[model samples]
Target: MIKHYCGIFGIYNHVEAARMAYFGLYALQHRGQESAGIVTWDGQKLREHRGMGLVPDVFNERHLGKELKGNIAVGHIRYSTTGASLIRNAQPFLVRFKGMEIAIAHNGNLTNTVELRDELERKGSIFQTSIDSEVFVHLIAHNMNGKTVEEAVMAACKRVKGAYSLIILANDKLIAMRDPHGMRPLALGRLAGSPVLASETCAFDLMEAEFIRPLDPGEMLVIEGNSVKSYSLLDEGKKPPTRQCIFELVYFARPDSIVFGEDVYQCRKEMGRQLAIESAPDVDFIMPFPDSGIYCAVGFAQQSGLPYEHAMIRNHYVGRTFIQPSQDMRDFGVQVKINPVKSMIRGKRICIVDDSIVRGTTIRTRVKKLRELGAKEVHFRVSCPPIKHPCFYGIDFSSKGELIAANHSISEIERFIGLDSLHYLSIDGLLRSVSHPEKYCLACFNGDYPIPCAGGGCSRACLEVTD
Candidate 1:
């Protein structure tokens, strides 16, 4: 498991549904960057093509337009949690099962997968992926004996635990479901006559789809023929308290998206303001790392009465260089991904706002660029608190040792990132940014995991892997 395990998107009843799904996947590409895939349904057939690159790299007219068909389509970008990080684990895992052609795209990791998988093995079910998600099919196969697909889904979900937001294709109906705790984000969108479902609302914004509210905690959704039905999976007293990940606002979700009724952009702004209050940095200008840090930087600059500037401009076309699996790739990745705007920050006492420092490799490189560009002083302002624990719900914080903040204090991190000062937003302020401040999860930042961490390492509790 890495960080966040890719985003899932689907579009229905549109002329260019596949392309729309591609755009949706593009908006959510941050969730997972390992690989990307899309599956579309023509009235009579299913068409899909995927590869080991970004969404644009995987899809094009020659490859996407001709091979992809259908009014309904599902898309996924992979960030494998427990299984092999290979083409096979790259989802939307499509298979013909139970006399129905099913394509399943999932976000989040399932606990109790091993037990469920052993049960399927006992029933003669052959395995495919190392993903906990694939165990879901086996659960449905072995446990779903109900009359309708919805009933079968409800039946299968009853057996599982931990965070999961999923979309299942069963012939005519497209089903989307979220774990009772709602650990991951899933939203339903509408475009003209089409109905869509995405891991984030940013997908809807990309296609001009009207953003709909998040699926209720413990809600089951069935989308078919441009309409949707929702039902709660738990009784009133049995509800799992809502714990949407706080990192979504700080790092994961696109700024344009809304989750749990909070605007990601606004939430980030609030985070920066809080970071300002937490760190109370003495600086000349508030600067952002660009892309993810813009919103938080805005809050920092406004609250601190410091001007905000882009000290570094990211080359969007560049592949995620640090995401490379090898040393050559990693070094080359940092080499190619960013270009410092020296003129914008040649000589300033800068307080740079960022989301969080994971491995600290990327931020260290970024700070080096700022220092090299002749900045007199560079201070790091992180919008979220220090991350000491790995995430098990869905994100791939696989190892505690890899985290810079896990073993070091703010002063130590300042030395590592080569900053004159380093400040992180307080956990309390981060929670305050959410629209419903009390409802979201802050396990990664605070180490107070709402759900169980399962075990120490990623192999046994595989989804917790963070590096």
Candidate 2:
């Protein structure tokens, strides 16, 4: 199972900005399920509603109508790449400093969080949340000495590293920025005449907004009243190479969304087609792991000329099992979330197509269950290459010890997962499936981190302790 990073949304100069943000968060619910939050600015003051759960569970008509009213707002859904999972860490993190009220919603992790946090703490700055996003607020506040909010934001951006796609709301303006590497996605849109921004185009679709374009790496925009202005954080002729996270196409973003200016569904389908060409296993029919795997399975079936069917049914109501805090709970949730169709697979040789395999436990359980349901033979095909390195730029697979591929060979993994055969798409195949492969960060598959991680390790301590 794979974990999702956070999603962020913001709107400026809309009558129902808070309500619109609520819907935007609903559309991005797939990106994060642990918590949801929305903060609004009403010209003079800020109002917000934050809670731990899915979007619908967190906000309702009463909360949206009574508590949040503004023309500018920002929303966030979190999955905890940094800090513990708690209410205090829930975002659209609101803070009051020097008589200015500001709210920030972030969608990626920072590599310099500990260093910045320590520096601020030593100067007597009190932190309200454990998440690295709070460091942005502190950094901006410290740099606000007779400077415009945009200037302060630029200063803060210069001080931080790693992946960050941010939506910052101040009393007068709404600011949006992406990291220099572009390791996360952030797009601009228009709702009626108001400016809108979100982590994916799917959010714009849900709100009936027209997508303008994706924010460039190291680009920052300031929106106020009905006007939008753009700025560059990087000095002229010093722009770093853009390295958008490749995994966003592989699994994170919704299939219906357009991320980094590419169609996610078509990309996944192409990956499936490539996988079929690379590893064509002889099987009776192709079966997907449900939802995320469905499109790839279709592409594989089309390419391999094999029958496709839904052999395993997924529970739409069940939240992602990977988000469960403990391994035991995650193992239990996986069983409850999917059930095999006994009659269809009673005596069939099935090929299972999934996005990627992380720990190997979930897939192992799935293969074992299929056999118990009387499957004659089970073959596994993964759309992406094995994840051999931990991701430090927002993905939750941050510990190398948790990745089975990091420790075992492909044949060993196949035997451990109880599969007749197992094959994964090569890195070259995955790159060919996308429009601009050179712009993607493939550190999870090949240890080529576009942005260097703190302490050169994959742990919470490593993120907090700088060399």
Identify the leading candidate in terms of TM-score: 2
Q: Give one digit per residue, the lDDT tens place, for model 2 in 382-418.
A: 9999999988888778788989999999899989999
lDDT of 1 by residue, 1-467 (tens): 13677689887778887889889999998888888988877776567687888888888887557788777888888776544677877788777766766778888877667666777889898987788778777777665554577777788888877788888877667888888888888888789968888988988887789986788879998887757888777867898678887777777888888877778888889898888877766777787876778888898888878777776777777645445557555545665666777787777888888887888988888778778778889888888888887776766665688788898987888888898988777777777777787788777777766666334333444542211
The residue-level lDDT of candidate 2 at 115 comes to 72
How far does residue 30 in candidate 2 sit from its true spot (Å)? 0.8
> What global local distance difference test value does model 1 have?
0.78
Q: Ten residues in a row with the worst lDDT in model 2?
A: 458-467
- Compared with the true structure, all predictions reach lDDT values of 0.78, 0.88
- TM-score for every candidate vs. truth? 0.90, 0.95
Runs in model 2 with CA error above 4 Å? 81-83, 319-332, 463-467
**lDDT of residue 39 for candidate 2:** 94
Residue 192 displacement in candidate 1 (angstroms): 1.9
